[model samples]
Target: MSFIRIGFPSLQQFCVNALVAVSLLVGGVAHAEGGPATAQDGERVIKLAAAADKDPLAVMSSAEGRWFQKWADDVSDYQFGPDKGVFWFHNGVAKGDLMRVLRFHHTVTTAAFQWQKKIKDPRLNPADDDAKTLAGVEGLLRAYEVLVAKNPENRVAKIDDLIAIRNKGGLADFVKAMPPMPSR
Candidate 1:
């Protein structure tokens, strides 16, 4: 869909498309089956979110000013869903199943990134700014925890790294990268 296109070439076109796209995207809501978490979906959600960030207008986080709260809600929805054991690509998924994960995660991460940007906009920011960003980072950490549990291998997503990028504190505070993983 045109709404899925991130980094549109022109700003004017982007703004117009974003306005129309947001409504269309949210118009439909697929009820969650509350099935078990799958490793494949976990990995896919983070990946899609990252890709969507390239163009802010493509998702709710960028277009919707109050996106962080919505993202917090999303985290809860997935976090508390019926505890089905995890699965990676090893199992299977329906067509476009991954797309839903992508849409959801991308919107969430984009919202967090935007908030991180807002509070840290100025180099000499206030302590409150760091606090706000950290709060957002914490939510992401929890979300990632559940995702990583699905398959630690997917930890390569280095989600903590994204949060660290926003923190930009000394390396001491930067989230560590995943340790070397063994080949399957």
Candidate 2:
């Protein structure tokens, strides 16, 4: 076999092309409701992203968006990160709602992007992100409470269970009984 050496210019061009292809592939990596993002939903987000002063929450009304939020709540073990240190997709999946759904949309797509990009430049600072994280938890709680309070059909059981757990000992006890996050 003969060995062929590629010049620096050729190798650099190859690298650039490879990165573009990988980016396109990663664009479809996000999932919703146990399935991948629908093609129409993807197109809508692309359009919204290009629009000036567009509301990201508008995407939450999309088909994939609604499903993803529910999926985030349903799947306690759902996460995106490396083995040791990484971004937690739904660190507290217990609380959820329309607002939380929109927030999760922002987290997984616009803010975090793909897994590789999210890991490189995570939105939350591991060292000093406690306040923001706590704020987010509180926000989810409020959203969930409001959703449950409005006589939402599907949310009553979840809220009731949470209340029951809280009544038992508190959120602390409830969380202590939660299964550990699955390995990435």
Candidate 3:
């Protein structure tokens, strides 16, 4: 007797659909395993981010950034399957520094706007105030130079790691730091 072969498109579709459903179920369960971040933890993360942004030079000079970079690189090597998650965590952390930079820019802009408003005020000297603002901006730029000199790849690397952390739990920490929303 000759061997018989069977090819069924409907059967293949059923198998595919079953696999998709099972995968989604398992993924949802795995994601639900991690608990939410506490408010204290969130605040700590926010503070770390703010501090890094405020004085990147200081952070680069300290042992912390060096240690963290090494740790992150080490993690990158061993955890091949979770690479995306780790990178996301790093990116989230890096965004904190960027947020600080944006805040600094806003501060300077606000100061300039105030100076302009008081330009003609008898008590306020717009020129002197403007000079101080420019000085502050120059100082920040210098700090950035120092930071980059110490860790040339820091900003990008940190960002990648933070993104991974966010995907895992770092983003939750940020949200917890935010004031609670009022009930509708």
Candidate 4:
């Protein structure tokens, strides 16, 4: 059998492309149409966040706009970075009217995302393992729904539950245990 030989440069490019594809898939940044993300795509998310009753502009400006820049770069490759753009996205799993939902969104964007990207501990870094980030996001989304179903006013309990679940490494199980979001 004859084997095909590839050059190092070709292999490196292939690896880079493969990594980009995998990251897009896992990062939830890929468009539904399977094309490279664009400024409009990022803008759409920002609009959705604004409609969700959260201040996208404010979040964009928070923490000296550090996280905001990273999130924008993730989706738009800095074509419209936080310095020049405001962006946010609600997955429609949580109600924006609920204070708990709003707070959770803020926490996820500012705190959770930071930890997931930076922390070495698996317990703190949801992105440490394959699919863990998705699981964590889904868990938080479901938790928002559960809290909305019960009481939207109390945010302390919501925060406590999040901390408890993260500490216990139970995000996937927590997602399974949550009641389904009511159909609109």
Cα misplacement distance, residue 154 of candidate 3 (Å): 4.8
Global CA lDDT of candidate 1, please? 0.36
Give lDDT tens digits, candidate 4, residues 63-154.
32333344444532222211000111233322334433443344333233323344323333323432333333543444444443344442
lDDT value, residue 182 of candidate 1: 31
Per-candidate TM-score against the hidden true structure: 0.26, 0.30, 0.24, 0.28
Q: Model 4 off-target regions past 4 Å?
A: 1-57, 60-155
lDDT per residue for candidate 1 within 39-97, as digits (tens), equals 34344334334434343323334433233334334442232110011112112321132
Alpha carbon lDDT of each predicted model: 0.36, 0.37, 0.35, 0.37
Residue 3's lDDT in candidate 2: 13
**What's the CA error at residue 65 for candidate 3, in Å?**
17
- Residue 133 shift from truth in candidate 1, angstroms: 6.9
Tens digit per residue, CA lDDT, model 3, 1-184 = 3211112235654564445434423333221112342333223323333344444433433343343233223422111111122222333543455434423432332222323343222114535444333333333333344344445643455434434655575554542343322334
lDDT of 4 at 98: 42
**Candidate 2 Cα outliers beyond 4 Å, as residue runs:** 1-138, 167-169
Show model 1 residue runs off by greater than 4 Å.
1-8, 11-32, 61-107, 110-184
Candidates in descending lDDT order: 2, 4, 1, 3
